[model samples]
Target: MFKGDLTVAAAYLTPAGGAVVTSVSPVGLADRAANEVSFTTSLGFPKKLERILHNPRVSLAYHTREHGFATHSHYVLAQGRAAVDLQPSAQRLAELMDASELFLGRTKRGGVWDWLLREYHQNRVFVDVHPDRIAVWPDLSASGPATVTGAPWPRHPAEQEPPKNGTTPRVPVAKLARQIAALPHRLLAYQGADGHPVILPVTVTGHDETGLRLAASSELLPPGGRRAGFLAHGFQPQCVGVSMRTVTGWLTVEDGRALYAPHTSTGMTAPPNRLVTTVANGLLAKQGLRRAQRNGTTARLHDLAARHRAQGSERQPTAFEDAPAQSTRPQR
Candidate 1:
């Protein structure tokens, strides 16, 4: 290969179990002598070459592209090779000015040229491949008119199985959404001052339709400001023959830390108030469905349903006149 060409680079099986094609020369290429027709690398090769050249049977393929057709110009197959010459001690200290210049030219913007040169000096090696046979294959598809073969190039050890979908494991979607909605309360529930609910941040461990399961607490903040207190809220819905309608959890505060109580249980509950019944009745009325007359009790349920539905749609919740007062803990 000549200078100023990127495609003519050499590929080698590295000792550390990988295939590498580097423009960086591990061995000096031009020390062939005054009139010698052959050349070798500066050092022998990486120790990996020991395993690779053990049998001394190898094939090297080269591709030349011209006018949309690739022409194979120089393909050399070699065998029965041995490390014949060690790099001369005198030449070991000797540096190749051309390789140094090539190294400098190879760098891009912002490269530390001197540092790379030093590294190259420490790692470069030279190898001499003894030729047993040589072949030049012009076309790979034709499988015709080719010379030199022992076996295909040894498989590189670095080839790994393509990962399934390029990832080790993946998560499902629907369950993830439910976990997100329930995360805040489940993570932060701890006992607040005077039994008030302190809300904490939550990191979910798992999730499903029922609730988000927790692996860790959400009480990560330091005490101060509006966050000093906690509030608890619960919601439960009831419907005939729908035994699964229930959702409840607690929020709490303790020791300047807030956390959510775990969601340990659930079940359908009767409507919370007369308004709830009124709202349910309104829903039925809007559908033009009236319950059979039963001591006018169904009418009362309808009225209650209407009331609850109206309250539910309020822009801001109305404080219950008999709502439980939040307890305040004494400051330490």
Candidate 2:
């Protein structure tokens, strides 16, 4: 299903136990025998990289839509351990770029490939992921179990070694509440019947010391009560910093509202140094200039660069905390 599509979302755990989900482009997929997937990204070390380095466990989701009289889609979720290869062979990088160009229908010699090659050579890393479990929803409307494969979904590594005694550390619900209130956006990820992960940008309707009240579409809520992943992240461009919080728990729909009982929660942040931020900002400016030239726009590049600088300088920091875990008793 991922053959031609480049868009995919990767979810990984931060040191603080938060899950960071972000959009990524799959440069290439290894053969089933190899049991690995590869993607390429900018050279600068981002927050996601930190999470992956600290914890190799990750989840990757991909889906494709068919539009027409009757809309339909197919989705897959691959839970795996990702290894970041900082020094991949140049030949491998070239092959991946070639595959990306072919999938994008770009000319082999020049065009986007040329620019991508230059960028790849200058700064880029390849992340190879090995799947441990895969779940698929072939049809969205079908009320059936997802086709599951591979090993059972492992609990967060931290959970494996619960404190010496049986008692676990109590999550600070009040702290989390305050953090959620400050977040500008929330993302909810659920598995659709069609075997794909659906990520929705939602608004936090209300929150208390216990849990959060989120506004979500009933369609995204699976029937018979199921769990979903929620993530909230804030970007502070001025300081080139990012903070993210994650929750995994059961979701229920009642009276047109969704109640979330967060089972596990975690949070983390990435604050780059001033030198790194300046370099990144410069890269952003150069990219904008290239885009403007390609689009035949005049002097828009500088404007775009200025806008980025202003947004970075002014955006506020967002804080996040973990939500309290809900009971495992089956929902009625």
Query: Of the candidates shown, which would achieve the greatest TM-score relative to the real structure?
Result: 2
Give the per-residue lDDT of model 1 (tens digit) for 5-99.
11212223322222222112222232112111122332222232343333222212222121111223332222223232223344543544334
Query: Candidate 2, residues 143-218: lDDT per residue as tens digits?
Result: 2455656653332121122223322213555566676666554666654332223455566777654456777545
TM-score of each: 0.28, 0.49
Where does candidate 2 stray beyond 4 Å? 66-72, 105-117, 140-143, 153-282, 285-332
What overall lDDT goes with each candidate model? Answer: 0.28, 0.51
lDDT of 2 at 93: 68
lDDT of 2: 0.51
Query: Candidate 2: which pairs clash?
Result: 17-266, 18-266, 75-195, 75-196, 136-195, 137-194, 137-195, 238-312
Clashes of 2: 8
The regions of model 1 sitting more than 4 angstroms off are 1-47, 53-55, 64-116, 140-142, 147-332
Clashes of each: 35, 8
